[model samples]
Target: MINQTGKFIVIEGLEGAGKSSAIALVNDLIEQHTGQAPVCTREPGGTPLAEKIRDLVKIADASDPLSDEAECLLIYAARTQLISNVIKPALAKGQWVLGDRHNLSSLAYQGGGRGLMPLVKAVSDACLAGFTPDLTLYLDIDPKLGLTRAKSRGQLDRIEQQAIDFFERARQTYLQLAQQDDSIIVIDASQSLELVHQAIRSQLLHRLPLLFANK
Candidate 1:
């Protein structure tokens, strides 16, 4: 059922998998196809308040451990604001929503990478409350290469600076979810940008034909 609302698409990947760029490309493609600019935004900063929370969470020197549970809650908090302020309103107005990151990040980062699998269900169940993406693009990449690219970009955030093992687990977990979930499409971001964009466009066209079709 096309529930009288717009579809929500989330772009997910490790730090340097080009999620931001892919999101911009996807947003543009959606607009070009649908003739309406989707509500494009990122997590932990979609809303002004949430952006503050993001800064705190990303601070490497913060005394707080930012426990997996806390991290999950903080992400949910940002998501709540994002849903209320951006997502729901856009969907109600029949505008597509393209999010750069979503709960999947916490799932892979905390549950898989940080070895907090047990906390996954609790936080996800209580916090998410059935709000799931219609489609998730997981840009898969090697952690070593991804981190190197990330380093070149600039200084790393707390999570961005995590050890190679951490990101390896994160990437693995994302791939695992892609295997298990039909909604997730895994793309090899190790390829060149042009190839990656082509793959993503193809996948989006195949999965969201209605959105891309003649209106």
Candidate 2:
């Protein structure tokens, strides 16, 4: 339902929520339907400076630990860089942008998990008051199962190494936000990958029929 020629689509979820596969599916669908490959981007990355910021955010250092507020600021700093340098340009060029993670991740992780919603909100408002994704696919999953799956992937990052309770709060916040916003579609990630893809496709076709109507 977005009026812009280029749309911003974001995928959000906790670690091991199968976001990688979801991104692939979304990319394929966008290309197939539009005959144009969407520009893919990931928050805290996509640009050189942003990638460096991503490393800083992910790596754990006992000697110089990152405080909750500092972590939140770092995430926004990286996001601002990505948006200014990559996302905005691609969108202005009439290219659909598929984002691996967007602002929602911060709202969940920094706000809910870290219990710093007020500061997160202030930063978000200052940086991106009017910006929003055209569509957000949120893969919902149990934190314990998500952590187990994440662990199976190899070494965990600093945020991923957090206790289960942290992810639980994040999940709760995701659900609450999804309930309030029609633009966000929640998918049960516990199901098979095929089922999750089906849900995503179904939601896309139903919610944004105009995008694929001619195709």
Candidate 3:
């Protein structure tokens, strides 16, 4: 077996941007090189306590609708739980972390969509102790088409049922952040599934030296 080296790879996108498909591709490549599946985690959930926090944020109760500020606080609380309980320990053990989403989601959704960038950034600064993904694969897609795809799968969740403009704003934030960060790579998720996978493969080939450095 190859030597165990830790790395954190995150898959990010608006809903229906094919994040799951992208995650599978990245997971496969890492497994092929390491001979083991990476430790998989999803934001807003991952640990038991975090999962409860996820439900609190993702479910809508009109009788007691959540304020945007409270939602942001709750998300960070859950994120801290996952990061401290799951992600950090795994990395310390030299295991890769294949995360479904991470702090970027809050930056885009709460900060951009909900127009709480200042609050989100402040909370992020407080909770995040300089942890960041080694690489982020951002699958960019049109929110209109992405919503259609998300709807086809099943009923929309609380967040999924947000106004189209909300997703549009979030998309813009994701693109903006990608532009500013070299560690974040943008993939045209609007393409066919195979094409999306091909793009991910090419990027991994170029940037993922850890997997092959010892080969």
TM-scores of the candidates in the order shown: 0.92, 0.95, 0.96
Decreasing lDDT order of the candidates: 3, 2, 1
Winner on lDDT (1 vs 2): 2
lDDT of model 1, residue 119:
82
Tens digits of lDDT, candidate 3, 67-177: 999999999999999999999999899898999999999999999999999999999999996788988999999999999999999998899999999999999999999
- Per-residue lDDT of 7 in model 1: 76
Candidate 1 lDDT trough over 10 residues, lowest sum? 206-215
Question: Order of all candidates by TM-score, from best down to worst?
Answer: 3, 2, 1
lDDT of every model, 2 decimals:
0.83, 0.89, 0.91
Who is ahead in lDDT, 1 or 3?
Answer: 3
**Between which residue pairs do clashes occur in model 1?**
none
Sequence-dependent TM-score of model 1: 0.92
Error of 2 at 36 (Å): 0.8
Judged by lDDT relative to the true structure, which candidate is superior, 2 or 3?
Answer: 3
- Count backbone clashes in candidate 1: 0
lDDT of 2 by residue, 1-215 (tens): 22347788999999999999999999988877667888999977889998998898999999999888888998899999989988899888878899999999999999999999999899999999779898899999999988889999999999998988999999999999999998899999999988999999888777656643422
Error of 1 at 119 (Å): 1.5
Residue pairs clashing in model 2 are none
Point to the candidate with the largest lDDT: 3
